[model samples]
Target: MVTVNLGMLHYVIDHVYGAFMHRTKISPPFFSRGWGGSKLELLERLINQLFPDVEGQIWPPNLIQPMWKTVWESKNACLREGVFRTPCDEQLLNALPPESHYARVAFLTPKFVSPQNMACVVHLAGTGDHTFERRLRLGGPLLKENIATMVLESPFYGQRRPVLQRGAKLLCVSDLLLLGRATIEEARSLLHWLDSEAGFGKMGVCGLSMGQYILLLLLHF
Candidate 1:
């Protein structure tokens, strides 16, 4: 098991940190939420943005499942928000509404202030039983700040609950790991999509707990 300490370090320095320094490559002039008092009207502005809202609704074989009802998703041309991990089959992508642009925008939304021409910040949630509405509620302040219009997303624990039957059964470590991998896999999909479909800009991800882990994976990718 990955220790919490090193794992968090891997998340911050590699992923959350330096979102702007890298965005400098594209000479991006915009900024997301500023870290402190740094102010810029265009700090968190969305340009050529796309929001792809998908659903991760797992109807397990068992009629009675423990996992949450659904996992919400949000991806945009500029910023995507959700936990989209499992590999996408042709059917899945095709099912999604067609996109007008080939590449979408992305953002980090760090508490920093710059202009609007910089890269983007992407925010994903960690373990929680949050519904789409609830997630949006939590994201209200940031969104209203118009801090780089986040693509609010969902993770396994976010809205999709695990098999309460099995998870509650208190299974072995392997079983728990199996469950965890599926959740992480869902998170992986989001990063993969950003890397492949989003423009070739400096991308950064931020979250706590599971969010942190997913951010780490994004950096490694």
Candidate 2:
């Protein structure tokens, strides 16, 4: 014979129910579907091997000029897009085409350029998101204040998505890890480019979901 405390039993039942619903819910997609425990361990080892001892400036050592091509011009704002080529932290993939081995950025700036004291926000969209949600949100408001805006499409996203992948989100966890490695490096290069440019002395970053988390990580990096 056993006696169960009603309060404790209710709490345990609620937690169990919540956990079941959480794992069963399909609204928030997962990128690690094909990654098994062993594969996750492999990813961990690879990361440790590459970054066992790391020390360097986040900005690029050699700041280079990026060719900014105006894709769209309007009375309110202008859009400039360009690709910045840089090496990844590791050689995970070989035989990548020159065009595919680069990072891209789109700059949406006010029609009027202020030499100084102008604000600029770097907008990072969600992971696997083709839509520039953050840019769309900030474009109008920021431009109203005479601020500039830029969007960075994540690696393995947008046109950068691998042809082998069927969807926007990655199926292989290892591939996703590799993308993270390169994306962070490319983001650092972006900072270098911005630092050299005028009116970027004051900079801010905005992101959504995973992108928001990336912004937080960039602060520590």
Candidate 3:
């Protein structure tokens, strides 16, 4: 019927699959910064209308910071081995900007920081897989540039295991899609917090494979 490569699979995962899963019917604000600018803007506008009160909130204080001791250790391993398990704290598992409000949203914080750079570029991994060697190769330049980085375990991948490991038993992709919306909302909450607490303003997003595809959809519709 249809030929599928990693690239194609990623596209379906980000757009078709992701959309079906994240069916909230909220419109996003439209703007031109990258691609699909208009559609994402419309969707953002819709989200804002639906959730007007979901304003930017402050990040949790050190005391309230969601414990990620396990996540922290796993992140260390990701530094060493590329991919790490998802943190148990599901509350922290969302993307910033909530897609509800058209706030200045940015994803991923660079491992490195450089004042000379005005723009931050991010990389998104596919299938929640990476090798320590790959991280070393890919992460260095981004770090040098001080680009922000974020690692998301897509519904069935990475730290998104608890929900996905059920394997065709409990929930299918459709079920996971609902979870995906929650993840996006969570991400938005985190983004708002970062904006208020970390002082990171609007920046660009560069998603590899599925992430890129998602970014494209974000740009278009």
Top model number, TM-score: 2
Scanning candidate 2 in windows of ten residues, the lowest lDDT window is 90-99
Could you give me the TM-score of model 3 versus the true structure? 0.40
Measured by TM-score, how close is model 1 to the native structure? 0.34
* lDDT by candidate, in order shown: 0.36, 0.66, 0.38
lDDT of 2 at 168: 62
Model 1 / residue 137 / CA error / Å: 5.2
lDDT of 1: 0.36
TM-score pick, better of 1 and 3? 3
Residue 76 shift from truth in candidate 1, angstroms: 14
Best by lDDT: 2
How would you order the candidates by lDDT, starting with the best?
2, 3, 1
Q: What is the TM-score of each candidate against the true structure?
A: 0.34, 0.72, 0.40
